[model samples]
Target: MPESATYALDTRGERMDALEQYFREAARELREPGLALDADPDAVHRFLHLPAVRLQQHMLTPARYARHDDVLPSFVPAEASCAEWILAAEWLAYGDPGMTLASPGPALSTVVLRALADEAQQDWFFGRTSDWPTWAFFALTEPEKGSAATELTARLDADPSGEGWVLSGEKMYIGNGAHARVGVVFCRRATGPWGIEAVMVDTGDPGFHAETLPIIGLRGARISRLRFDGMRIPPERVLGRHRPRSRRGLQGALQAMLWFRPSVAAFALGVGRAACDYVLEQRPALAGAGRAEVDGMIDRLNRLRRLLRDVAAEIDAGSPNTFRVSGVKMRAARLAEDATLLAARLLGPASLVEHPWLDKAYRDVRAFEFMEGTGNIHRRGVFQGLLRDDYFTSRDRDVRPGRVAEGVV
Candidate 1:
C-alpha cells in the first residue's frame, strides 16, 4: 500500500478535538493584553517558552519524517493529516493570534530545512537539542529587497581560505527574528542561476543583530529587523549542493512554500471563522442589511473552508497542486479581510471602541495577504495555471506530438 494510505488514522478526529481543547485552555490563560500591546517584552518571551515546551512534549514538532514505502523517508506530518494541521491552526488563530503568530517561524524553518538541507544537516539542526524547545526561523524578506529572490541584496561572500562564509545584510519582517536560536538566511552568491543561496545563521553570533519591530497586530509576536554585519558560518551551514550541476537551492524554497501556503490560508480562515461565529450569535439583534450581510459572509466563508480542505487533501496525497494552493490562498485572504470587516460593521461601534478582539482580528487577518504572497500575486499565479494546457486538457494544447490540427481534420 502507498504510504499515504498506510498512515491514515481512524483516531485523528478524536486526537484533534483533545488538542483543540488544550490550545483553547492555553489561550485563555495566555490571553493577549489589550491596553499596552508590546509593553512587557520579558512577559511575551515567557508566554512563548512554556507553550513551546508543551508542544515539544506533545510531539507537536511542525514537521516529522515517515517512511514513504520503506524505501524513502518523507517529511509528512507524523502525527496528523495536512487537513488536521489546518484545523488545529484555525483554532489557534481564533483563540490567540499571538500564539498562532509564534508557530509559523518554526514551522517554516522546518519545511525549508527539510526540503533543502542534507540528512546530516537536518538531524543536527532539527534533532534533539537541549531540554528546551529550539526555535528557528526562515529569513527571506530583506530590508530593501521585496519578495523577489532575484532582487536579494544580502551578501554571502566566501572566505579567502575557504573555511567559511561571511554574511552581511539586513532582513525585515522576520517573525521570531530576535528570539530564534537559529535561522536560515537567504543571500545572493556571486555565482548561481539567480545568485541566490541560503545560509544558516546562528542568532547568538557576535556579529548578528536583531531589533524588535512593533506592528499593529500580533503585538506579542517578536517580529524584528535582523542585521548581519559580519556573520560567519562554516561551509556546511549553507544548505543544498554547492556545485552548479547539482543546484536545487531556490527550487527547494519554492517547494517549501508550496507545503506551507495552505497553513497560511488556514490562519486567515480562522480569523474569518471567528468573525462568522460572533456575528451568528448576534444575528437575532441584527436586522435588514446587517442580517443579510452576515448571511452572505457565512456562505462565502463556508465555501472558502471547503476549498481549503480540498487543497489540503491534494497535499496529503503528496501532490502539492500549486494551482489549487495559490487559488485557495488568494480566495482565503480576500474572504478573511471581507468577513472581518463585515463582522465589525455588524457589531457597530462596540467592535472598535468597546472591544479589542474583533478590531485586533481585523488587523491580524491583513497579514495573510502578504504572508505567502500578496493577493494580487496569487491571483496572477492562479490565472497562469488556468492558462496552462495540462490544467484542463491533460496535455499541452498548443503543440501535440502525434495529433493533427483540428481544422485540418
Candidate 2:
C-alpha cells in the first residue's frame, strides 16, 4: 500500500478505537437512566442537543447508518475500516435498539436516490435538502408473495405524457414508515411481464400515501404499509436499466440496500457483544449459574464478534469469500438470538423490564433478521451462489465479503 493508503488505514484504526470508546461510554450512560433524563418528548428532543446518553445515541445511531453507507462505495474509506464500521453499528444497536433500529432511515436509502436520480432532480434534491430523512418502505414486499424483489408487482404504467407514470399497488413492511420524508417505491411497469422493470416512485407525489403497519416486534421502527392510487411519478424516478420481463431499476436500489446486509449483521453482533458484556459483569449473582456458563457465553459472543469482523475485513480487502457475507449475516442473527436469550437468562425477569438498555437491545436487534432479507433468504442466496458458474472463478466473487447476491430483483 502507498504511504497515503497506509496513513488512511492507521487513521481508520484510530477512529475505530475512538468509536469503540464512545460506544462503551454511551453504553455506560444507558446503563444509568437517572442520567438518560428528560423522557418528556419535547424535553427529550431538547436533551438530544446536549451531550448525554441520548446524544451519544444520536451520534452512534447515525454512525451505524454511515457504516452501511460507507460500504456502498465499493471499498472502505479512511474513516472507518470495514471491521470498525461493523463494530460501530453493533454498538449503536446495543446503545438504544430503537434509535439504532430507526437508523438506516434516511442515510442508507438516500445514497441510492442520489446515485440514480437524474441531474436536474439530483441538483434539486441536494440543493434544497442538505440531508434527506428517509426510512424506505422498500415497496417490494406484498401481503401474499414469495418475498423476492422479483415478486414485487406494483403496476408502473406511466401516463401517455412520459413526463409521469401511474403506480398502483400495495407495499408492506416498510421500515421507519410512520413519518419519513423520502420513500422509494418499486413498481412493475404496466407494459411488462412478471419480472419487469422497477420505477422508483417518489412518495411526495400527489396520489402516494403511507400508513403504518403494526408488527409483532420492533415497535420503535414504525413499520408501514404503502398504497399507490394512480400515483403519478416522473421518469427521473426509474433507478436502473430495463430488462426482459424484469425491472433492473430495483437492481441498483437493491444494490444500495442489500449490499449492507452484512453490516446489519455486524450491528447485531455488537448488540450481542454488549449484552454479553453486561451479563458477564454480574455473572456470579444467579443461583445455579457457574463460571463455565458465563465464560462459555462470553466466548460465544467474542467468536461472533470475530466472525463479523472477518467478513468486514474481507469486504474491505475486496476478497470476500463465497456466500461469506450470508454466512456472517446468518451467524450474527443466530448469535443475536442466542445473546438475547442468554441476556434474558442472565438478567432474569429484568430482561423484560424497562428503564434499562438490555431489553431495548434485544428488541431493536431483532430487526436485523427481518429487515435485511431474512436470514433464510440470504442463506438460500448463498446456496444458489454455491451452484453458479460465476461463484467459483469471478474476480468479484473472490471478495471474501462480496455484496449480497444481485440480479434477484
Candidate 3:
C-alpha cells in the first residue's frame, strides 16, 4: 500500500501535499537554532531571516496588502483559511514548536483584529507589518483574573480630558508582549459583558510597559507581563465601534478562540509527532511491547490529525462546532504529553542528557495546555456539549434515546 493509504486522513489532495512538504523542509532549519533559542530567548532575532520565518511574518496578511513579490506557496488563498493555517501550523510546529512560536508575526492578534477591528484599524495594523517584520500581541489574560472576562478589572475609562479613553490595568502571560510594536488590549468600560471592549494600542506609548518573564518551556515565545498606566486611546482606536455593544469585546475574543482552537490542537499534534518520530528513529529496530506502543501512538496521532483538519475545515466553512474544537484540543494536548513521556520512558534515563532535541520537545509540549485554554476548561466545554446533545442525533438509531454509550460522551 502507498504511504498515504496508511492514514485515512491523507485525503487533502495535491495542494495540501505541496503545502505540507514546504513546511516539512522548513522544519529542518529550526531544529539546531531551537536549542539556542531555548537557552536565550532573544536568539530568535538571528534566525528571522530564514524563509519560514519570513513567510510567517506575512502569511495572514490580506492579499491586497500583501507584497507582489511575496513567495508564499501558490496553494495559499487570497484570504487564508483556518484549514490552511492549521495545516501550516502542524507541519511547522512539527519542525520546532518553540521556533514556530518565536517567529515574528501577528500571531493571536490577527484573529482579534479580523473579528473586531474596522477597515481603518486593520489598515493601520497590516500597514505597519507590511513596512517591516513586526510582532503583535493579544492582551486579555490578567494576573488575578486569568482571562475570565466577567471578572477582569482592566478599565478603559473616559479620559478626564473628555477627548478619548484612558486604559489602566495589567495583562499577564501575553506572547510577544515585550517585543510587539502594536497590539489589541481587552478592557472593561462598564460592569457587565457588554461593557468589555478591545482597543488597539501602540507599545511605543509612554504609558505602556512590558517585561519578558522567565519561563521554563517555550522560552522563545517571550511570554511577558504588560502594564498600562493611563494609556491613551483615540476614539478611532477602539475596536468594534461600528458593531453592536453586545458583540464588541467578549464575543470577538470567543470568536478568535474558536477559529484558532484547531491550530492549537495542530501544534500539540506536531510536538507529539516529533517526540514519537524521535523515539522510533533512535530505536529503529525496537521490537515487542515498545514497538507496539510507538506504533499505537502513531495511529492515534494520525486520527487526531484528521480530527484537527476536520475542525479547521468546519471553522472555515462558517459552521464551527465549539465543543468539538475544544474536545480535539483537550485530546491533542494529552496525547502530546503522553507521547513525550513515552519517548522519555522508552529512551531510558540518559536520553534527555544525550539528546537535547527530545529534552526540548518534552518541555515545549507542556505549554500547549495553557495556550488557548487549559484542559479543565476544555473538559467543561465538552461536558456542556454533552448536556446539549451536540455530538449525536436522533437519526443515529444505534444510540439509546436518552443515554449515551459508556465512554462515548
Per-residue CA lDDT of model 3 for 1-409, tens digit only, reads 0123222333568667766777777677788888999999989889876766655666777766766444454444434678878877888788887888888777777778888888999998878766556888889899977867777789999999999999999999998899999988999999998999999998998899999999989998999999999999999999999999998998888887886677778989988999999998999998999999999999889978876777787788888888888888988889999999999999999988989999898899998898888999999988998798785334333757564432222
Positional deviation of residue 35's Cα in model 2 after best superposition, in angstroms: 13
| lDDT for each candidate structure | 0.66, 0.54, 0.82
TM-score comparison, 1 vs 2, better candidate: 1
Q: What is the TM-score of each candidate against the true structure?
A: 0.80, 0.72, 0.92
User: Which ranking of candidates, highest lDDT first?
Assistant: 3, 1, 2
Candidate of highest TM-score:
3
Q: Output the worst ten-in-a-row residue range by lDDT, candidate 2.
A: 34-43
Cα TM-score of candidate 3: 0.92
Q: Mind giving the per-residue lDDT tens digits that candidate 2 earns over 1-409?
A: 0112322334656756655665555444332332232122112222232222222222322232332232122222223445655665666566554444444234344445443555654444333223423334345577776346666667877587767677788878776554555566666664333444545545666777787665544454566777888887676656544233332555545554544676677667667766776776655464455446656766766765665576677766767664657766776777777877777776667666842565555666677787666878777766776776433335445545634242111
Q: Which stretches of candidate 1 lie over 4 Å from their true place?
A: 1-42, 46-81, 103-105, 127-133, 191-194, 242-247, 282-284, 389-409
- For candidate 2, the clash count comes to 17
CA lDDT for candidate 1: 0.66
Model 1 is weakest, by summed lDDT over 10 consecutive residues, at 66-75
State the displacement of the C-alpha of residue 118, model 1, in Å, after optimal TM-score superposition: 2.2
